[model samples]
Target chain A: MESGTARIAVDLLGGDDAPAVVVDGALRAVRADPDLHLLLVGPAEAAGEVIRALDPAQRARVTVRPVRTVVGMADHPVAARADSTVRGAVHAVRDGAADALVSAGSTGATVTAVALGLGRWPDVRRPALIATLPAVAGPVVLLDVGGSLEPRPATLARHAALGTAYAAVAHAVAAPRVGLLSVGTEAGKGDRARRLADPILAATSLPCDGRYVGLVEGYDVSLGARADVVVTDGFTGNVLLKAIEGAYAMAGGPPTGGGAPRAAALLGVAGTVVVCHGAARPEDVAAGIGLAAHLWRRRATDQVRALLDGTEAGDREERTDRTTDTEVPTS
Target chain B: MESGTARIAVDLLGGDDAPAVVVDGALRAVRADPDLHLLLVGPAEAAGEVIRALDPAQRARVTVRPVRTVVGMADHPVAARADSTVRGAVHAVRDGAADALVSAGSTGATVTAVALGLGRWPDVRRPALIATLPAVAGPVVLLDVGGSLEPRPATLARHAALGTAYAAVAHAVAAPRVGLLSVGTEAGKGDRARRLADPILAATSLPCDGRYVGLVEGYDVSLGARADVVVTDGFTGNVLLKAIEGAYAMAGGPPTGGGAPRAAALLGVAGTVVVCHGAARPEDVAAGIGLAAHLWRRRATDQVRALLDGTEAGDREERTDRTTDTEVPTS
Candidate 1:
């Protein structure tokens, strides 16, 4: 709802049906928001397709980076170092040409490119991909959704802090309650990582009036009954998000509010980045673009980073070895 | 459905709502199934309530086994050994007094009691809790729902075999395609455990014509579009099941077929057993009792065990140290 001129770099050669789907999505986004501008980073032909679809007035808002290289979904994260469109989009943000970037490419590649190009936050070892689900109560912020697939307890605790800030800053949830995702709501009812993370999360101080609400089950993620920000490892969060989307499909359609989000905002980095599903439809890519614009206009990335800095400064004495295993994102 | 006299031991002092929900579920099950007989194991007062609600003919099918001890959900699994109702129910199954047992108590307690009383299969180290989901294509059998929370690679491979055999024998799924649940369908898409278990599952031979379909996402669990049997760690399986149930609730109701199952069948034990949700309603407990009766009438436990024996005997060379960490069921 923050209306301003937000320039977003769109990776046109990203998704499975790239170029076409990305072109269609960019066109839809350009038409929807008058103040929104797009930096199309892909083949010139694909960028021209989007530009040609818009009227002369709308064409003034579109620009092209013209990068032809693309990363496949099966490529390794190191592949992002190549001259790819995702890397190009990240460069656009780093160079201040765009406020944010959106990609539907390989998650690992996008995460790596963003982290390397834009740099991660000072204390963030692994950047968390935060997906906000429209649950019954309100927006449920689920973190580490395919960003850091094998995060340690410390990383999970840090993501909890990040999610708490994101929920309050981006979604405008007051006094957000954070919970560690586990099999059961009991104190000692989860895997070894969860058992270790539970104590760490409880002892860690949260910003934005966010309180730690002990252990929560999967029901809390969808129902939003117990916690507003649900923290979990990327592996569980990724599969759980997809499972809920599939369940919605089986149940005919989503609820009155909306379904599981196809795009997630990548936090812990220096700039705003939104990642759509690799097999994203045109509308999903549009949503990703819209999310990027929204986050950029709100300055959510900088505000969340500042919030984390204050919390970390408050608890700096207890976080000496937190970044020992830094840069281990298993996407 | 298999029609036969199926006597099931009902744990009356189980679940959050305990005796009241247990009694209502028992009465509903007894009235619904003509050939179903129940041996209610709990306080005599709770048993009398169930008996008093039934007519003369139905009352003849109900019996009571008074056991004052109970295992709370927060209690350790070792609490089941203290003459608890779950222990009594397990003993009934072992002594041939009941065809199967149904409980809505602590999953750890039930698993511990059943594994100790009836004993695990010779080749099986961890007993799997299997929950069948009515998916779009057919029934998708998810194993290790709450039993064996943190299974090793060998245990997952073994559970894959057990799930495959159970799908063929219990659900009558012919040549069921089995999949190892992960974040993505790609070959190297999951965590360290999944990365190690993937190759092992591919090398292990399956029984009843079951084949490994490689890695599958969580959508396959609810949609059943890729595989009929999905294998994952109990921690992931447990949370995934509850999340699906929550999603169904958020979607207004379940599909015409059904929603996420509240009851899961315990396999690798010597007898048929059904463990309902810890916070089960009366209808959920009734569904658990009905599932127990169905599994017992079909002689699924015996049949699945025999099929697993055939599979293990054929692949004995590669599985010498599978039982090193046996009896580790972290519910």
Candidate 2:
């Protein structure tokens, strides 16, 4: 939808109904975005089905990277084979064949492949998966959705910066308010991880003029009245996101704006990567591809990285708590 | 509603809009259940208002335990004041004046007072707060909603048993299936606590012919198809409950069966105690009182304890792996 053309690498064997859903999603994506070009990564036969479906003019926007199954390897490990497709998709982004990548594969496989292929950002130990939920007030950015499960207090503090920066750059929010997710909004309301992270978030400087809003309850993730960005350990964040989606389904539908997002932007990694739910449908995969394209055109990653740099500099000058010493992993 | 008379102690000065909402709630509870009696705990003026509003026959069903405040105690801590109505309500249950107690007060205050006055059940460490959400399949019992904040792996396993027993005794579900709430249903899917608790739950013995069903995702809590009772730490459970409630509210109203429960039953304690949301309205408080009466009539607390005893005895005889040594703390 943006002015500039964005090329995205689509993983055809990523979702539960891989290849079929992925091909269908790719067709939808290409049809929706006139300025979008996709480099399909999968078996040649599946790629051929996508190419044959498009007319001459639309077909010109598509490309394929043919993959095949080697004979005499019928009993190969599933993990090894799954890792190949994700690695190929990551390599496409690294080779300048695509501006970004979209996958609905196992989050661990994608995260590992992406982090290894495209190095992590400086000062970020664990890459964060960020999901934006449509709240009543505005968008609520939730970080560590599934990238890293057991984040230390320092990793959480670092994610606070990442989330604040992402909220401003991706969502175009001015002076975003960040909050640490916990059971209650009161001080000392949550478990050990949250109690320790509270003071650290309060003391740490946030990017984009973002301010830490103490502890926020789960309702704030959907309602967004208290904070624009909610930070938590990946385990809690991932389950909470899915739980909200389920709650919406049980309630008949989502609120006025939208429901819980199926696609999440992988931050803390250098490249533009969008990870959809593993059980995502064709429409969800298409939406993930569209999100990746949008982020690439908006230069969201660059802007967020720059914001974090400024925040890091300010923090260094203001506080003398900077140290390489590791603290206990409370999460 | 049941055949037996159930007298419930209602905490008058417990919620944000105490006395006013509590009085209205008590009136609704009395009207709904012909055999229900209420022991209203608060000031004489507040009790007098409820007494004056009811008909002569209905007024005879209401009794008051007036809690007089000191004339010059403006600096008294409202939560710590020994003469607070929640403590009085707890005392009423301990003195055999009431079959159960219901409060929409501060959760911490209620938990502490109830544990101290009524005493905790043997072999139960931290009592769990259990909330039953009306899901598509049936009622899903979620435990440790707010009773204990950060529980160890053993505590989580114990809560699983507590939830399983609760689902059977309170909801009358046969062979209740229990699941540990986690990010994914895979074997090694969650953070440290869940990773450690998953195997323990799978091995632990469940009551009422209950069985442990490995890890369950967030959707399982709302759908109830995967497990009858979902177990998690109090923090996650608390937030999840509120988020579901908020989702139902945003959807205009709850589904046909009703919305996320505003009340939760307290387990691990000897007495039957029901806690409503602190921000509950008059009708929510009334529903919570009604729930307390219903559970009392069913003798849910005693039945759940007996179920636990049966399971523990069976475990000891089977010589299963009891090396986990996780004890549910009775506060």
> In candidate 1, residue B246 scores what lDDT?
93
* TM-score per candidate, chains pooled: 0.96, 0.93
| Alpha-carbon lDDT of model 2 | 0.84
> Fraction of native Cα contacts kept in each candidate?
0.77, 0.62
| lDDT (Cα, tens digit) per residue for candidate 2, span B154-192 | 788778888888888788889998999988777777888
Candidate 1: regions farther than 4 A off: A317-331, B317-331
Best-matching candidate per lDDT: 1
lDDT of each: 0.92, 0.84
TM-score of chain A of 2: 0.92
The true-structure Cα RMSD of candidate 2 reads: 5.1
Q: Where does model 2 exceed 4 Å of error?
A: A68-83, A321-331, B68-81, B318-331
